[model samples]
Target: MDRGEQQLIDLVNAWAKYSEATPDADVAGFCLHYLTETAQPAVLNQHSPVASPDGLYDEKWVESLTGTANRSLTEIRPSSRLAALVGRLSKYGYFYSKKAMFPLNFKSIEEPVYLIVLAQMGTPKKSELIYEMMVEFASGIDVVNRLVGMGYIEEFPDENDRRSKRLRITEAGLTILQECFPVMNRVADVAYSSLTEGEKALLIQILDKLDRYHAEHYKLSKNAGFDEVYDRMVT
Candidate 1:
């Protein structure tokens, strides 16, 4: 890995240790330090976190620091800084999710498949649900196929388009998620407890910004049918 990526991985490992030691500290601060430190300025001043009066960080600033464009931070790129951070968090999330849902093993069901199924059951609209998950965690068709093979989910013909399909989590999948709900909640609590209230809010704000930005840009790319945009970006 490059220095920046290595630093991020190291910071995440440190945060994991810190969470175990001081589960009520400011986790957001720690994560922000990781991102901002590797950022272009070499040393991030207070102004770095605060979006400009126009409500966005300078494009050149991001590019110079991260060796990528500001647009990369949005949906255009799969491996943006925020995307990498979220990917790491999702791996952590999947680990916890699996731990929570253990003992009811679906040998063929991968982490991404489980996550997608969980999303479908939680949200009403399949498209919206998939979009939300994509924003929070990216996955591909191969993962979905595995879920189908495992009988955890089924794809039905969309009423509007026979060629397209909609996903539904099977009863078995729902049962697993229901059993795991409490444990998953605890996992979230454990993860978030590492941050103070202020730090939690700040981290939420930063993530929300990245999520929204990506959603918008993702839509644009989809409209243009730009499939290859994410080909080189996944971790």
Candidate 2:
């Protein structure tokens, strides 16, 4: 057979095997499977916990999470499990980033982040900056006050509205923020060290989808109660 015919036969055989393994997967998913197996053979599949590309999770440990026993994962839905992982990862990232920021005279990551945002905003109203961060008014005020006290940022009266105040990063803030970029990069490096390039790309696609969803909902849910938000967004 010619090379083109041979390749076509191989694709058919691969599709047959892939359909057998993943009965629910669509043609698009099979195309990805075929490409992953043939074109990008070095990049391992992420389905099996045993075959985790990072090799951080132990197969035996993963298999043990079942039944009505203590610490069992039997009742946890995939969404709940994923949420828990996201929470834990956020906490871990906070820990590393906290340590990373401490040397720059920042008590928390918020200080430098506020300066960075203000710098990007080129003098935003205090409320505008706060809302951009999605923080409570009091908490945002506290950070602003601390930054003002530290000489990292300054507040000025708005030209149009004398009663309104605008915020911007100062020279000192710029110096410190320049120093923080590399440290924060290291923190990110540690967080993403386990994932391969393909995995990272795929994860970014999934996370960006989630972030866009939440960004819209956060605005609507700001004044809403838990049940009110849940009923509207979830059930």
Q: Number of the top candidate by lDDT?
A: 2
lDDT of 2 at 17: 86
Query: Taking the tens digit of each residue's C-alpha lDDT, what string does model 1 give over 118-235?
Result: 5656433346445544533245455556666767667777777767777777776566556656666676876677889987887787788877877766765654534565552333
Q: What residue runs in model 1 are displaced by over 4 Å at the alpha carbon?
A: 1-90, 95-98, 106-139, 157-165, 223-235
Q: Where does candidate 1 have its weakest 10-residue lDDT segment?
A: 70-79
Off-target runs (Cα >4 Å) in candidate 2 are 1-74
Give lDDT: candidate 1, residue 212.
Answer: 82
lDDT of 2 by residue, 1-235 (tens): 8999998998888888888889697887887666645663223323332233344234323433322223333333456556656877887888888888887878767778888888999989999999989899999999999999999998889999999998888898899888988888898898898899877886886799899999999999988899999998886
Candidate 2 residue-wise lDDT at 113: 83
Candidate 1 achieves a global lDDT of 0.57
